[model samples]
Target: MFPKTHLTIAAGATVLVAATVLMSPSSNVEAKRMSYALDLEQGSVSAPAKGPASADEQNSGEVKTDTASSSAPTSGEKGQTEATVAAAPSEPALDWQAFEIKSGDTLSSLFKAAGFNDGIMLSVIHGEGDADKLQRLYAGETIRFASDDQGKLAAVELQRNRLKSLKVSRTDDGFKGQILTREPEARPMFASGVIDDSLYASARAAGLNDKLTMELTDIFGWDVDFVYDVRKGDRFEVVYQDLYLDGKKLGTGKILSARFINRGDERLALLYTDDAGNSDYFTPDGKSMRKAILRTPIDARVSSPFNLQRRHPVLGVVRPHEGTDYAAAPGTPIKAAGSGRVISAGRKGGYGRAVVLQHGDGITTLYAHMSRIARGMKAGSRVKQGQTIGYVGSSGLATGPHLHYEYRVNGRPVNSRTVKLPDAKPVPSSEMAQFRKVADQRLAQFNVFEGREQQLAMAEEE
Candidate 1:
């Protein structure tokens, strides 16, 4: 009996040693079994297993993580999991479609092409806040839209340009729209060039766009005759605003100051705004750069001049030509020579379609032979100076397309080309101090740019 008991005891001790070895900390299976829960939900661990608190938990008063657990995430794995959750988008993904606006494309047609009906489009068009701007859609713009799973229009965006857009979204009440605009960073820019062939050619060589070139001419048009006075040595210096978006040039802004040298005579114009928000170009001594009326309303050469004893081109008789005739292409815009009220707008005997404006100081101007009158130009309607009243056309008894312009003072016909134009009002006495401040600043900027350009030219010459 004693021998049998000894053998049984020895076998039990061996089995106990095998169990301890399987459960040891060094064993891979044991380490996995003792792992902590890596996933946490709602800022807490659910159904946590009771264990001794780690040093971290003891100091921070937080739940302890089972470091011995094989399922516990490593530092890298923990970071990755947290990042993924953070990176998850809050809104659902959408499939957007883009459509480019072409010529003659209407909103209805674009909506139909995008698999939508006119009803949806009308709703978007009738949306709030600048939604009416969509009615005047321009070519080369883009439109993007998205729909829900139910095929209902969810959102629409009109990309007018790179920096301007309009976005409309679906709401319970109705579609709401908001104009989105990105302000471009404005940087001062300068350009200078001497005229050899023409103002446009020299301006283009100096990196000035057609718009800026025209503006430069208009700034000095009151004092200089660009059509006849510009010489080969005439030069121009412009300090303007260059707009940029994301380090790329978007376009140009206003001309801050400009200097034009015409026929060896230099004229400078500085832009200024008064306390009442009236903005105009002015000379250094506070003289208005604008004249009461334009010397020549249109930018065309004089085909016929005002004369008292001249032979008529069509009638073949010696008659008094009271007005000057400008030769231009058909459909060229004719401008209002000065701010005035239209005394007459319609056919008048020898004059085809004519518009006569009655101005202050008993001055009257007439533009005859127009293809069509601009909208809002009618008898008793007021017009601003430089506003387009009609397009060039041979409406009256004429040989070809031309504008017969007449300017009169006190009911007496005068030579529109040779008559001295009256000057506009100068800077108000109350605003002279403010005007001087702005003038000085603009002049300083202009001078600095001019100096820089001269240095550059000298360096190139060397």
Candidate 2:
């Protein structure tokens, strides 16, 4: 059944094909030629194949051939190939250098020190977005640069702080800028203190910083006089926030809630944010922590008290001293007693450089013997409570540098130290339920801290 002639011809053709392939260049040589073609298309230099390649070269050639065959365009791949050709080339590996900002380091000087030209600096500063951050660089900040083999700026990064950075990268059009931010983790912290000598000392003993101590004073300032009302047994507890980044503590955050017991009177304050995004400290019963007026306009020693009949120091006559005098440094700032509009700001006969503010409910406050009234504090100018109105000085007929402060109701002088200030508006009824929930949680945390402290104290006593 075999056809010898046809079978012999088929075998001869296979031998002829094998001979042609063997006479041709090796697989490596063919791969080199194809690779050269690809390099030419990509505008890259290629070396000519010189001699017979090793087994590794042959294997690599097979891979390259397979890759080329796979990458050959089909009906659907034609558009993709064109798009790839039009796209920009991949950037070369960059050489990065970090520079610490120095006292006299200007942007120009920094660029020059980094081996970059003025053109690159200008282009980066005038980049697409957030380029203004470059102008606000501080002396302690750090800036990093990346350049290509050709010494062209590829990217630049300015570290503003631990959690913020500004980055500028070169694009086909120009440089593009972006601000990068890292959110910190908020960890709840609890601290409690019992006053032994002062609020600051006790707070420090309880591992609280000066900033937190100041905040504690401000939270209870409406009801407690830190200078006078603080007793040996007064205690305080606070639940606050501690910020952490990458497992390292950054600093303290807002005071979530606080409790202060002064002279056996307990006061609780909770931080609450309403639907309108306004935040303030409030009592568990929804009353605001702030008052309409502060108890003292300035932190100082009271030099003179309000007396119905007294002999004036300068006039040497029997005059009714209607105001309290606070002895302070010459340039100590005097704050407004309440939120009001200035009624008068001028020199009086005995009260020089006086500024009077008139508040609601027939209340008026006067600050006199000022070295200089605050700029823009003219008649009809609105001011907030605790805003600086003037500085302390012996500007009037006074014997020393002090502030003469007066509180009046219905045109009658009253003792500023003994007068009671009205409380601020309470939380709105619509948000009272939500406020109570937050207050309860914060109070519970504060109580837990207090309980722990009490247990520790009892153990020590035992």
Candidate 3:
């Protein structure tokens, strides 16, 4: 618009007026033509148009200058003058707009906010593949909308996480969906900590998360009694996997190796997976780190020991207390001591809400006084070792929230504690060599990290 078309016409008109004057008695028309040309070059002639002025020109109170048309040829030059205007190239238009999902926002509401109706939203939701996942949008996620020139929905993108997303695009008949994913880079990491007060505090100080801390306890739970044996000076070292994407940390994976020092005894657990895809922790000598049963199922102190002549606190008389009582907070999970099948999972006379597991060699374990049994845990259901079977609660004849754990051999109640637990099967002879090689390598890594830590400590002391 700044290159005004009116200027070209005005210049031609000036030439025409000059020629008409030359044909008259005025012989100075040539001089007038040159004067008009000079005026045109200096932009002295005002160009008047019928249309209202543009906002820019009106606000500034100035006329728009068209440099290209300012030097336009006059009508007297040759037959006439014509200007060839070139078309400008167009730029690509952006059609996508992104919106962050907030709490309580549904797919319908999001579509409406993106300027779409329920019909379009339903079309997207019913698209092929993972398009239905849009209905399960979570807070802190992102959703993008792409529209056509007519402002109709063209495509929809749902960013679920850094590693995964779903995109749905409009097609002739309906919508088409496709899922996208990215793989994270896995790297080895090392951490070591000396317990000052508790395991959780020390592990956190050493940069271990809650999941890794719990996993560490589980790896060594069979050998060391974490509830009573962990002391102030007990230390731990772990080599684990840290996942990353484009140099940014995502989360942690699995622990490769861990060493725990409890009560002046060192226990090492190295993770190894066989060719058959079976994975478990093993000692340096190829012995399985697992036992026939866990030392204690719940993370709590023993309130009552198994005694044949102990007086019952609730009965107020001398009664044979056969099971050991573990006192924990209400609703604390009680894990299975070993893999077994449930023989009974109901209320007993004195023990309310009890579950008895049938094991090999005529061994059976009993868990009594639960707030409630875990789902899928019923009679004849098989359970794995360390699986949660019930919660801690004083169900029937009890004083407070506690678990009465009994380990019976051939229907005879035995002391749950002080009884030597049988060892689990060791590494298969076919894979012993492979396990030893992996264990040695992982243990070497642990040693290297330990040496580096010790050196740093000594340097700091000096």
C-alpha RMSD values across all candidates: 11.1, 11.1, 17.0
Candidate 2 lDDT = 0.86
Residue range with the least summed lDDT across 10 consecutive positions in model 1: 35-44
Model 1 per-residue lDDT tens digits across residues 289-386: 99999998898999999999999988999999999999999999999999989999999889999999999989999999898889998899999999
Q: Which candidate number has the best TM-score?
A: 2
Q: What is the C-alpha lDDT profile of model 3 across 287-319, one tens digit per residue?
A: 888888887888888999999999999888999
Q: How many clashes (backbone atoms < 3 Å, residues ≥3 apart in a chain or on different chains) does model 1 have?
A: 4
lDDT, candidates in the order shown: 0.87, 0.86, 0.85
TM-score of every prediction relative to native: 0.73, 0.78, 0.73
Q: Candidate 1: give the clashing pairs.
A: 34-69, 35-69, 35-70, 352-396
**Could you tell me the lDDT of residue 417 within candidate 1?**
77
Candidate 2 on 188-221: residue-level lDDT in tens? 8888878999989999998889888899889998
CA lDDT of 460 in candidate 3? 100
**Candidate 3 weakest lDDT stretch, 10 residues:** 83-92
